[model samples]
Target: MMKEKGLLIVLSGPSGVGKGTVRKELFSQPDITFEYSISMTTRVPREGEVDGVDYFFKSREEFEKLIEQDRLLEYAEFVGNYYGTPVDYVRDTINDGRDVFLEIEVQGARQIRDKFPEGLFIFLAPPSLSELENRLIHRGTESSHVIANRVETAKKELEMMNLYDYVVENDQVKKASERIKAIVVAEHLRRERVEARYKKMLEVK
Candidate 1:
């Protein structure tokens, strides 16, 4: 029997929605089996960062060539630097029967959806707009103006929840992590995923 292909699990949300925090929590769990997809970037590695571990560092020309070749699943430019997921890595990992998890921005998630509609898309939403705004303010890393702009953008992103297969609310970091894990478990057990395995068994019998 052929081995089942693994899932492409995407987790995305608006800025200041604690996506990083929730992802860290989820990955810390021993039971989590998905491999994190390392993104490629055209930027200098920060101190203590390692290539192929932190990010697959690339030159602007090299990265652009990848774009031209359509080797990237999704990519975006921010502050003159390009960051993206490599299509080959994702495809190879899943084909090897190892799930690949992507933690990315809302726009990047949309891009992934376009290319991989069969992948599981989960929208990480804040409990409320006011709560989201408050979390942004508490972070104290951005200017008040920047915070306001992010809140507005988050409102627009929230509307995109309809595009996702599941919505996991960020009520608490632990709770959100638990919910996401549960979703992944359920997705693996979905009928469509298991039907082929069962059918192959019957054929062999």
Candidate 2:
């Protein structure tokens, strides 16, 4: 029998919804093999952030060139910076039969809906909007103004949650990750994902 092709998992959420935390937890699982799609950005690197690993830092001109060449899978401008997923890496990884995970914002996710409808889209949400604000405040990384802005942006992003195939509430880190893990497992067993592989095997006989 032909082996199943890897899934393209797109994870998205509001700014303070802890999607990254859950992604990190998911990666810790030994059996799940996935390659992360690193995004390219026109923003400057922060302290201790490595090039190509944390983000592919690019000049505005370089980023624009990629856009012109249609090299990006999905892209959006946030807070005056350009951010996009590189198409080549993600395509190659999935073609190689390894799952690829993309952690992106709602705008980028919306774009993906058009380009990659077959991919599994999961939305990570906070238990409540108020709780999302609290988490942002506790982080102490942004000014009150920025926090308020993020909260407002999150409220808008939450409205788009219905667009996703599944919604995982990030009330607790571990629980959320487990829910996502379950989703991945279920996706693998989906009839559509398996039907083609099995069909090919039958035809060969």
- Relative to the true structure, candidate 2 reaches a TM of 0.83
User: RMSD in Å for candidate 1, one decimal?
Assistant: 5.6
Off by over 4 Å in 1: 129-157
Error of 1 at 185 (Å): 0.4
Q: Which stretches in model 2 have alpha-carbon errors above 4 Å?
A: 1-3, 129-158
lDDT of 1 by residue, 61-123 (tens): 999999999999999988899999999989999999889999888878999999999999999
lDDT of 2 by residue, 54-167 (tens): 799999999999999999999999999999999998888877778899999988999998999988999987787656667775877667787787788676766778789999
Pairs of residues clashing in candidate 1: none
Q: Give the number of the best model, judged by TM-score.
A: 2
